[model samples]
Target: MVHVSIHSGLLCSNAAVVRSFGLAPKYEWFDTPEPSGKNEVLVDVLAAGLHPRVRSQADGSHYTRPRALPLIPGIDGVGRMANGQLVYFVAPDTSLGTFAEKAVVDLRRSVPLPETVDPVRIAAAMNPAMSSWVALRRRVDFQPGQKILVLGATGNAGQMAVQIAKLLRASQVIGAGRDSDRLKALLALGADEIVSLADEPERVAKRLGEAASEVDIVLDYLWGQPAERAMLAILTQRSDRSRKLSWVQIGSIAGPTAAVPSVALRAANFHVLGSGQGSVSTANYVAELPALVDAIAADKLQVNAVPFPLSEVETVWHALSDIKERVVFVPTQ
Candidate 1:
């Protein structure tokens, strides 16, 4: 089979540290060639997202993958194949990333984009949206009618989490965030109520405490003292004396360390677990790809996205680093 390739890909490959997050870019545009294997499909990268965590990986702070010099750092993107089908895939490592004109990843990792969906729109949902989908599906052990609290609710992953909870038909979806402006928007995105984090945690806790009986799960993105207090208050005041709380930690945008009370947790059957989308096996990815794709195609899931052309990657990376919202980079356009 004959294949075409492009060389221009966004890079953390530079020797100079990018000013945005105090990290050095290492990966250089070594190559952008097509795959020769049967199970691997070369995707023409149209768009990619600049995840802040990718910067962490560059700085050698991200808990996963040790920092290796000269690695392309991107976690997600959308593109098309030689067959002309639109597909989006989140290439895990800082290697073989999607910040390029083209990328060749395994066939299983790619999900088909619907004909009606713009490539940029589909690409926008690749990174943060998957966090919501994968976390709720694999970690939360969520069931219909289970009430859940989503921290950082106005955020990309938070918003997506709210939508995923409703997709599962969660009982009471509470969205928590510092932005009341963004909170109000959650009403249409399946959040039954929005809790602003701007106020004191105690105040927010008291407000939620009244309805605590209905909350069964907590999807925590903010991990500071506020989150700790909120969790504690909710756990202690829940009306359903037997309401078991399950918390899934997906992010730490607020802060890393938290004073999690072991004694407080023991009060009820509360369970806490960390989720980082542990290396996905190829077979399992194949299975999950279809449903995830169908959800995006059907518009069952919504994502916040900003589209940019490939050449603007340098400026765009800065934009991504500064803004606390979702962004998608379109390459072929």
Candidate 2:
């Protein structure tokens, strides 16, 4: 085995360190990371969001799992460099993550943040909002007047998708989910209609068909049975079968695989595509960050963030299910 040093030194920093998969990270001191390549800079990490993607990364369930153990577990965060410049950084799939007191950031994978901006809010909103933001901007030929339906619209990222679809100028936005309260809440977030998935399968299908039959695009976060049912419902109810419909799969909160009928593809001018890490190039993701950061800074998007000390990472990890707001870890706290 390759022996690694854990001794505290002048360059040591506190972080939530994961020694193995399928366990909570331990809060401890580790050597501070240094910039090892061109355009890389060390930043004092102020805030890192605990997103579902981060949870998956820690548990070794994410498709792009880290190669080795003894890793930090944040994918993106807001930090201040040695020169006092604040920035939002996206961590590569490596062991040195943003969950530490300090992190080495690639300048190309980060964007300068306005000094006046709230780091916690930026840290919370960027990763979740980027799911749909990058999808509409990068993956598809989304037009301004097109209509949209967000399939798991009550969740954090799903809620952001409703607002983002509106912000991007979609003519009508429909929010669909199992939570009635959250579905009702989406109306205020620019969802023209809401469908609850709590009813019988036929009823849920009928509701989706009525609300989103003619939608130009579907931002699907739930990709299993719900998605399969919604596809059939929308396809059957569509007045113009030949009208192009783009289905962008961004997450699989419901299940990993869908038993989509082959006839669904043959029925209309339908296109199903996935938008995530591998499908979107790093350059494309980075290029879209400036505008997204600006939107969050300008208060165009709603953000609810709750900060916790990084030292309590283990406790917080277990309590996440009870927390409704986005959880942000503050290293200094």
Candidate 3:
């Protein structure tokens, strides 16, 4: 058995985790676990993504809840193994999460990282970028010339959806966001048009309505008010009722549920579906990573990542309010 020192955030079963937020979990030392499974390898963790979902997992609000206490609090990370090969891997079990100096993951769950790619960038980009890439590539039968409308385009995931759509040769990409400045930035990131959702519902509807005639797919991240508005807009612009539009619901940052109108569903050419865990097969999602990481290495996927030390999780954790950049935690040497 190889013994290694690790600083991991321990989640207590009885603790009110959500109330603590950036202050909870509290890191402590632990002996690394021995690997014992098919393709299982012990890894020296380099960088772990401080994703918003980690907080949700700790608080017991995420879809994938913590099954036991004293759990580490990372969903995924980039690590260097005993063999000296660097890879990115996901934690199938929350009991042995990625926010540590060492972890054991099935080698099949990991994708080998190129030497040219920064591990921090890959750690930050994959979760957010994969939503749309896998959704468009697997969920929907997307063609090169198809047009895409990205709802909540100002957020990190939405921004990545825009980039992926363009990289996949989307003929037209419309970005909808509440922030005009960020929406303008999306234009340079390959978005052909921008729709501002800061206005009243009627005005937002009008904007979406104008573009509804051209949108072949809608990648919705904010699936509350903006989604309702988009639906209303599509209802008004149903030029060809026979032409179906694919709407892939990925995240619900706006709210858990929306007040979707019954008429809106019956009136338009809309085929709404979800794209996340349990929605897509795990093996297929893993298959897409090599090429996706290659894209990041080639600088095709655009993402801004800010590195912080694992020891400073309490200090810098509160600074994750900026959705434009990803906050990554590098294990302290």
Q: Using Cα atoms with residue i matched to residue i, what is each candidate's TM-score against the true structure?
A: 0.85, 0.97, 0.91
Ranking 1 against 3 by TM-score, winner = 3
lDDT per residue (tens digit) for residues 254-321 in model 1: 89988888866777777788766564444554466678767777878876677766555566555565
Query: What's every prediction's RMSD, in angstroms?
Result: 4.4, 2.8, 4.0
Instruction: Give Cα distance to truth, residue 101, candidate 1, Å.
Output: 0.9
Where does the lowest 10-residue lDDT sum fall in candidate 3?
A: 10-19
Highest lDDT model number? 2
Q: Which one wins on TM-score? A: 2
Q: Candidate 1: RMSD over Cα atoms?
A: 4.4
The local distance difference test score of model 2 is 0.92
After superposition, the stretches of candidate 2 with alpha carbons farther than 4 Å from their true spots are 1-10
Misplaced by over 4 Å in model 1 are: 1-30, 33-38, 92-94, 279-286, 321-325
Model 3, position 53, has a per-residue lDDT of: 76
Residue-level lDDT of model 2, residues 111-141, one tens digit each, is 9998999999999999999999999999999
Q: Per-residue CA lDDT of candidate 3, range 200-243, in tens?
A: 88988898989766688999999987787678677567778668
Model 3 clash pairs are none
